[model samples]
Target: MSTGHTSVPEVLDALKDVTYPAGKEQLISAARQAGAGDEVVKALRGMPAEQYAGRAEVARSVRVDPDSDPGTDAGRRAGQARRGGKPGLSQHLREEPRTPIQEEFDR
Candidate 1:
């Protein structure tokens, strides 16, 4: 568990400019590079091993609401604003055509 409360925005801010579908190592590296404090780093390190498609997924995985603004309903609306109506990275991945090798492997 984290020693301090690390907000979702804090983590996202720390990971600014990070590429999507990032692995744990890359996320941690980005956080460290951004000079994230111990709590933020600890939260990221404790996340389950998986590919993260976007900040929202990472926020959810870390148990922080990407839309929450500390202590208000305003946070809910803020999340939509943050996304700017664009689809998440996972959505793009889902629509992407599988490579020939991948398609063959599935067969």
Candidate 2:
């Protein structure tokens, strides 16, 4: 039942490129038990090679500085204008002076 090797360097070699955050050992164990070596190989089998350019560790981009003005009045107004950006054609028509033909058609 045993391969007769104490430490399978091949298994560790298979895990060379596999990386994860701390405190996710349960998932790693599950993958091994389920016959998948690690998350990298599991993901690579499911995804196209072109879609992934390999992995690297990087800091989070969403965490901005405390000194940055994220919700100032200018920021709020800009966000509001962006959210309500569609021009109102009906309101524009109401503001415009009517032509003689348009006046006749209205009556």
Candidate 3:
């Protein structure tokens, strides 16, 4: 599992033999037994002490190095630009006109 950095696939490979609904300790131990490196172990150690249902759950729960995740690369980020994000969360509220309309009854 030592490929310089820890990725989801690498983490999953290390935990392949682990039982489902395993806790943090169980994961760490299994990774170590599978010859995982410090980075992988560290990532697993940082995970919350909860039962994991399966590989998918563990993959989602584990935090991998940003550099290792291609989805967050500079190219992807540029492509996903939000045009400086939304105008604001409450932009619609400010769109209402302040001046009241003159109705026949009011007149």
Candidate 4:
């Protein structure tokens, strides 16, 4: 759920006017030093209108498949090809290592 509000313009305005208690320069400096992504720093430097506009463009550029079929024979074949074996959580772990927190929690 959301706490404060849902207006895009208002959220952008808040992001533009957001102060880090430390300061804008400090925040920007920290963002730079911490190897923050280019998009993040760009959003910080620019105004709300620009940020929102760019975000809108990005959202528009995203290609969402509207014809997905999770139950078709082709879909099942695709799923099996992607999984390559086993299934579910076991398959995920085999492909990628888990974090320490996950290992501890699983135990």
What are the lDDT scores of the predictions, listed in order?
Answer: 0.68, 0.32, 0.69, 0.37
Give the C-alpha miss distance for residue 25 in model 3, angstroms.
Answer: 0.6
lDDT of 4 by residue, 1-107 (tens): 22222233322333343343333344345556666545444534432222223334322222122123233355545554575653221221223335799999999
Better of 2 and 4 by TM-score: 4
C-alpha-based local distance difference test score of model 4 = 0.37
Which is better, 1 or 3, measured by lDDT?
3
Which residue pairs clash within candidate 2? none
Q: List the residue pairs that clash in candidate 3.
A: none
Task: For each candidate, give its TM-score against the true structure.
Answer: 0.56, 0.19, 0.58, 0.25
Q: Show the colliding residue pairs in model 4.
A: none
Cα deviation of 106, candidate 3, in Å: 36
**What local lDDT does model 3 show for residue 78?**
51
Per-residue CA lDDT of model 1 for 24-48, tens digit only, reads 7899999999999887887787676
Q: What is the lDDT of candidate 3?
A: 0.69
Clashes per candidate, residues 3 or more apart or on different chains: 0, 0, 0, 0
Candidate 1 C-alpha error for residue 15, in Å: 0.7
Most lDDT-accurate candidate: 3
In candidate 4, how many Å is residue 20 off? 4.8
Mark the regions of model 2 whose C-alpha exceeds 4 Å error after superposition: 6-8, 22-107
- Report the error of model 3 at residue 46, Å: 1.4
TM-score of 2: 0.19
Per-residue lDDT value at 100 in model 2? 100
All candidates: CA RMSD in angstroms? Answer: 13.2, 21.3, 13.3, 16.9
Ranking 1 against 4 by TM-score, winner? 1
Q: Summarize candidate 2's per-residue lDDT along 1-107 as a digit string, tens digits.
A: 33232122333343344444312243234336546544333322322212211122111111112124244455454554445432321111112345799999999
